[model samples]
Target: MPRFVFIGLLLLVSYSGMPQDKNVSQGRSTTSPHMAWEDLLQEHVQEDGRVDYKGFLRDKQRLDSYLETLALQPPKEQWSTQARMAYYINLYNAGTVALILENYPVNSIRDIDRPWVKKRIQVGAERLSLGDIEHKILRKMGDARIHFAINCASISCPKLPAYAFTESGIESQLNQAARGFINDPQRNTISPKQAEVSKIFKWFRSDFKAEGGSLVDYLNRFLDEPVSKGSQVKFLPYDWALNDILP
Candidate 1:
């Protein structure tokens, strides 16, 4: 072979042999591990949205797997707003489930010492409690609709939807959750004469105001029977009983 041809062949072989960063070269999107958690929730939770802690305990391994993924693979900052919101919402809900299973058979999540504020489980590159995900992350994200999406494993907390929140469907799910929680007579007894709402509205009053306006304004937006102006605003006492369904 001619010297020039041999040199060219050697250069081509060397270039082909160069290593590429698998993560960078392929430009792979992050695969969410939340699917495992979502599947577990659907399988164990009743159609009414109450959870079966006993069944969740039985599937401890699956729960742990989901948590492991969360601890290691939290959503990247580069992701879109919807993706981040969906990720944190799932983390909060799934983490809450794990917290319940930690003390399975307990009557209430409050039975534990400051369960929400407790820093125990690992998630998103750090050990974060339920409160951290809710207050520190989700709340700062500036969407009041999150209150309806994150369940605290309690009777008074918003219902856990049968399906998990996804980046693509988060907007719709949030809207549905807001409407469901507000309009549900059981949770919030909104009357034209006297408006009674969930403690959530009272607790996160600022969020609702930010979302729309005052609590009454927010309620009127969803409520079929609008709460009349100057209607009595009363917050119902929160129930701390475990939102569990018996088999």
Candidate 2:
């Protein structure tokens, strides 16, 4: 065989034998590990999104183990958008629960001094507050649906999902969250002519309208009975009570 042909064959064999990056493919990273978080959610979060804090207290060690996994493996730039989105959403939620457990028997998350801005969550070498995860990272991702995914441990906040958000299912999961929150009568009383919606719409007005449309237009997408374009929208008072399952 010619020297150039032999060299080409050798190079191909060498390249094929090299270990590939398991986390990456086509410039996107694989999904983050979330089975532990999912298990915790299934065990403690109720169907209605209310939490069994006391149960969580009993399972604190499992929760901490999951959080430690996340803290050590901060998302990389190569991660798919969905992967990153799921990571932050789960991190924010798990971290919030950890925070609440740190101060169990509290009436509301707001009762904690500066609950959101406190930098207690450690991801890799960085320390981030819940506020950082929501505002600085998730919001910047430009997915309005996220507002319905991250729970604030409040009655008025969107329900905490019973399952962990996974990269493969993130899109559908977000759509379901938005639809559920928008249509749930406890959160929003909607009519063809008028609507009284959650304060979430008021607080994150820009996020809902991030895509080119009115807030009402956004609601129409999720409402079973679409509100009239000219319907009067009243923002309801937010309930800051903890979303705990009382015995």
Candidate 3:
């Protein structure tokens, strides 16, 4: 009888000594791991739009720990209008990169469509397809400017900002997205006679117009040189490839 009691006490002590999840320790509980957008942006951004993926990978363990906490938090009560938008934007960007990494070393994102990497990933409690996030959450959500924000990890895709999403910075974020994309020589740029533009402006011209006028008119607000009347617009070929920074 005494031996049985001693064994039971030993088991209890061992269980108590087990490490607890970090999120519980911090008082913010979550199931999955994620880094807040604010913290990510502060640490990653360079003067140019280029983000430091290497730095992110360096402290990946802590970042993953935080994300686990975020996931455990209960699903939000009625995604706030602004918060929903912000979450979708973050989802699309983060999910896209995560998707790309699933099949790294591919020539283009197209190759991943074969069998394995094309499978759905659960992001923020939503099982999302790369297309669903791009079309449904982003486009169907009634926002057109997103085309300029989420990077496909390609030179042609709009530069992905180093920071995370915040409601306070939404307007400025959209403005910067617009300006940076339009100014990218590979995405959209004006030369005296010949000009190149992103398929984004072509694919969703109506989305932009819903807010006011033509995309060119919308773009002119940000460009240094005025877009002359009746200037021809041509689509630039996009490289849908993995944007891995080779070591």
What are the per-residue Cα lDDT tens digits for candidate 2 across 1-247? 9999999999876543312223534323243367678788889988988999999999999999989978877777767888789889999999999999999999999999889998999988989999999999999999999999999999999999988777777787899999999999999999999999999999899998888799999999988889999889999999999999977
Model 3's C-alpha root-mean-square deviation from the true structure amounts to 9.0
Number of the top candidate by lDDT? Answer: 2
* Candidate 3 wrongly placed segments (more than 4 Å): 1-78, 114-119, 123-125, 191-195
Deviation (Å) of 246 in candidate 3: 5.9
Report lDDT (CA) for all predictions. Answer: 0.79, 0.88, 0.60
lDDT of 3 at 152: 69
RMSD over all Cα atoms, model 2? 7.4
Candidate 3 local lDDT, residue 12: 71
Task: Summarize candidate 3's per-residue lDDT along 34-115 as a digit string, tens digits.
Answer: 2354456457545455545666566555455444433334235554544455556665666555545455555666676632
Q: What is the lDDT of residue 228 in candidate 2?
A: 96
Candidates sorted by TM-score, descending order?
A: 2, 1, 3
Query: Best by TM-score, which number?
Result: 2
Query: Residue by residue across 132-245, what tens digits does model 1's lDDT show?
Result: 889998999998899999999998888987666666667877988888888888788876889888889888899889876677988887677788877889999999899999
TM-scores, all candidates, are 0.84, 0.87, 0.70
* Candidate 1 segments whose C-alpha is farther than 4 A from its true place: 1-32
Flag regions of model 2 displaced more than 4 Å: 1-32
lDDT comparison, 1 vs 2, better candidate: 2
